[model samples]
Target: MSQPMIDPFGREVSYLRVSVTDRCDFRCVYCMAEDMTFLPKREVLTLEELDRLCSAFVDKGVRKLRLTGGEPLVRKNIMSLIRNLSRHLDSGKLEELTITTNGSQLARFADELAECGVRRLNVSMDTMDAAKFKTITRWGDLGKVMDGLRAATEAGLSIKINMVALKGVNEHEIVPMMRWCHDNGYDLTLIETMPLGEIDEDRTDQYLPLSLVRARIAEDFTLTDIPYKTGGPARYVEVKETGGRLGFITPMTHNFCESCNRVRVTCTGMLYMCLGQDDSADLRAALRASESNDLLYDAIDEAIGRKPKGHDFIIDRRTRQPAVSRHMSVTGG
Candidate 1:
C-alpha cells in the first residue's frame, strides 16, 4: 500500500555523495597506475542530469551532499553546478557541501569555490618530502599542491589534510606533519590503506594501527579527545591549547560501516549504496530519457532501498580478493 522505502536500514538515509567526474589529473601510483586506462568521456553523464538526480534525492529526504570526483575540481563550470544545487535546496536542509581533492588544481579555483558557498575542504597529501611525494604520486608536482592548500586556507575554508599511512613510505612524517597541520590551523588525519588494489610491494611498513599512531603523537604532546564524533570514520584528538586536531581513520582494522551514512554516485551516474559493494544502479539512462521529477525521486528511493546493511571489507580483506576493482580515483574517494 505504501511506497517501498529505500535505504531504510533502521529507517534512515541521510547522506548523498556525488562524483562529478571519473577523470583526475594526478597519477598517484596507489590510486591508479600512471598508464591505466580511464573511463571514456562518452560514458560520463551530463551536468544537467547530475543536478536532476541530486534534486530528486533531496526531494526524497536526503540532506547532506558531498561532491567527490576522480577530482571534482577538474569538472568544468563546477561553480555553476554548485550554485544550481544551492538554489534548488534550502539552506539548513542541504546542510553541507564539501569536497575531497588532491589539491593540485584547487589553488586556481579556491576563491571561486568560496564564492559558491563551498566552506570545507579535505586535501590528500601523503608526504611533505618533495622527493618522496614525487615518487609516490609519480611526478605529481608537490609545490602546486602546497599552493592549493595555502590558497584554500586563505579562502577561509575549513581545512583537513588526509594522509594515507604507508609504513616505510610516509609514516615517519606523521608527527611532524600533524604538528605542521596544527600549527597552520588545519586538521590532520592518518588513514590506513585499504585492500582496494594490487599489492606487489608490502607498503605496510608504516602500517602502524591507529592506536599506535595516537600513542606516538601523544608521547610528544598530550592529546585531548575532541568531544563529539565529527562525522565519518576519523577519531578526533586535540592538543590542549592548539586550535586544530588530529583524526585517525583505521577502517581496515576497525569497521565503521555500521554507522556509514554515506552513498556514492559516480560521474557516470551509477549509484553505489555502499562503496565496498560492487553492484550499483545506473540512473543516467532515466535522467536522459525524460525530466520527470517523480521518476527521478523514485530512482533515488530505489537506490537507497538497495543499500546494504554494510560492506564486506573485512571479509574481502581476509580472502585477499580486491575489495574494489575500480580503485578510489574512479569511484570517488
Candidate 2:
C-alpha cells in the first residue's frame, strides 16, 4: 500500500477538489464578474490528464475526491469522467466520490450520476424566491433547480444544499430555507460569504456572519451539537425539535485552517494550498514534462511544505482591506 499524503503541518491531506472546467452556466453575482473570461479549450486539462492526475493522488493515499467546477456538469461528457473515477471506489482506492454543482443541469443527469456510482451531491441554492434566485444567479431558473433537486432525491442521491448567506440578499430566507430542508429531509449548510473575488457588488456590504445566522435559528429551535465526520470543514448540529441537521461553514469568523485536510487543483492544473491565500504550485508544467509521477509527487510535497500556517482573512482594522482578492469561481468554490 502507498503512504498517506501528509502535509508539513501533519494534517493528512486525503481530500482532493478538482476543477474540471472554468466555464459556468449561471453568472452568480458573488461568484463571477460581468465581463468574465474563460480559459481556452487548449488551456484546460483534458479528461485523460485529469484521470492521470487523480490517479497519482490516489496512489499517494488520497481517498476522497470531489469534482468541482465552473459547474462540473457543464464539461462535455462529464458522466464518462464520473464513470472513470468510480473505478477508484471499485478498487477500494477511494472512500467516496462526491460532486458540487449549481443544479442547473442536474435534472437530466441525476439518474445517470447515480448509475455511475456518484451517491452524494452538494447543490448551490441560495434562495427559494423565484425573483431573488434569478437576481442572485444573474440568470437562473428556480423551477429548473427545484426539479433537479427532486430528481436527485428520487435517484437516491444524498443531497445537501449549500446556501451562501449574504446580508441583504438571502439572509431573510435562512429560516425558511432551513424549514424547507427539514421538511424535505435534506441536509442544509449555510456558508459565510468569503472575500474571494471581485464581484459586481461590494462583498463587504453583502457579507453575512454565520454567528448571526445561528442566532436567528436558535429563536425557533434548540440546536444540539452533533458528532459527524464528512471530511469537510462544516460544523454539524441537530435541530432539537425537527431532527434535521444544519451545517455551518464559518471561514471568516472561525478559521478552520488548523484542521484543513484538502488541496485544490484548478482547471489549468494549479494546486492551491489554501483557498484564502494565493499560495499555489503549477502542476501543469510538471505533468506535461515528466514521464513519471515522481516529479508531480515531489512538486505536491514541496507545495504542502510551504502551505501557510493559516489564511490571513481578517479585515485589517486600520486599512479596512480584505486579504484575498481572487474570484471564488476560479478557486473551485
Candidate 3:
C-alpha cells in the first residue's frame, strides 16, 4: 500500500513541506505587507488534520517532512503536531522531521522540539545589525531571536542561518553574516530573492543575483564545491578558511528544477506541486469529503501527475509584478 508519488518528469516526490499557519510575528519587507489579512481560524486546518495529511504523504513515499509557516513556531499547539508526526521518525518511515522558523519562538520550544525528534532547524536571520534587522523584519527583535538561537543550540539542534541577498539592502552584511554564522558554529545559506507575492517595494530594486554574491565571496574566502543537499534546492560548498559549509539557493541566477522532488501544502490543505506555480489541488475538500483517505491519496496522485517540468520565474522591470502573486509564506517557503 506504499504508493510512490512520482511526477510526469519521473521525479519521485520524497519531500513534503507543509505550512502549519500563515501567521507570523514579524512583517519582513520582502515577505509581507505591514497590514495583512490572515485566514480565519476555521479556514485553517487543525493540528490533527496536519498530522493526518503529513502521515498520508509519508505513506506515499515522502521520506522527509518539513513544517514551515509565516513562522511555524507561531502556530498554536504546533508542538503537538510535531510530536504526533514524530511517530513516523520513530517507525523509521520518515528520515527527518524538521521545522523552518524565524527564531521568534525557538526559546520557548527548543527542548520540546529536541524531544520530539527534530535534529535540524533553518532560521531566517537576514542581518546581524540590530537597526538593519529591525528595518528588514519591521517588528522583529534581534535580542529575542538571538536568545532563541542560543536556546536551540543548547538544545542540540543543528541550525542553519538563511539570509536573503537583497541588492542595496543588507548586501554589505553578507560576508559579516557568513563570518558570524561560522563563528557561532552554524552553516550559512545565501538565497537569491525570489519574485513571490506583491510587497510594498518593487522587486526589481530588491532582487540581488547570487552570482555577484559568489564573486564577492570568492574575493574574501576560498570555497570548494561539495556534494551536499538537504532535500531542498540549495547547492553547497565548503568554506576552506572557516572550515564550515555554505549553501546557495539560486532560483534566479540558476535553476535546479530538474532535480526538484518536493511539493508544498498550505495551512488550508492546498497542495502545490510546483512552488513558483499557482496551480494547486484541494486536499481539504477531499479530506472533508470523506473520513477515509482514498480521495486524499487520489487527489495527491493527480496533482503530482500534472507537475510542471519547471517554474517560470522572471523578475521583469517593466511589469514589476511578482512571478507568483501569492507570498512565499503562503506557499510554505
Highest lDDT scorer: 3
Candidate 1 wrong stretches, greater than 4 Å: 1-8, 88-92, 198-208, 241-243, 314-319
Candidate 3 — what's its lDDT?
A: 0.92
Q: List the residue pairs that clash in candidate 3.
A: none
lDDT of candidate 3 over 60-168, digit per residue (tens):
9999999999999999888889998999999999999999999999899999999999999999999988999999999999999999999999999999999999989
Q: Report the poorest 10 consecutive residues by lDDT, candidate 2.
A: 314-323
The C-alpha RMSD in Å for every predicted model, in order, reads 2.7, 1.5, 0.8
The TM-score values for the models, in the order shown, are: 0.90, 0.96, 0.99
Q: Between which residue pairs do clashes occur in model 1?
A: 6-304, 6-305, 7-304, 7-305, 167-205, 167-206
**Whole-model Cα lDDT of every candidate shown, in order:** 0.76, 0.87, 0.92
Task: Please report the TM-score between candidate 1 and the true structure.
Answer: 0.90
Question: Pairs clashing in candidate 2?
Answer: 196-326
User: What is residue 175's positional error in candidate 1, in angstroms?
Assistant: 0.5
Please write out the lDDT profile of model 2 over residues 1-333, one tens digit for every residue.
Answer: 246677787898889999998888899987888688888898888898898888888988888899999899999988888899899999998999999999999999999999878899999999999999999998789999999999999999998899999888899899889989989988999998777766677777777889988988898899998887688899999998878999999988988889999889998899998888898999988899877888888888888787776787763235244466667777686
- lDDT preference between candidates 2 and 3, better one: 3
Angstrom error of the Cα, residue 52, model 3: value is 0.7
lDDT of 1 by residue, 71-108 (tens): 88888887788888886444555767778889998889
lDDT of 1: 0.76
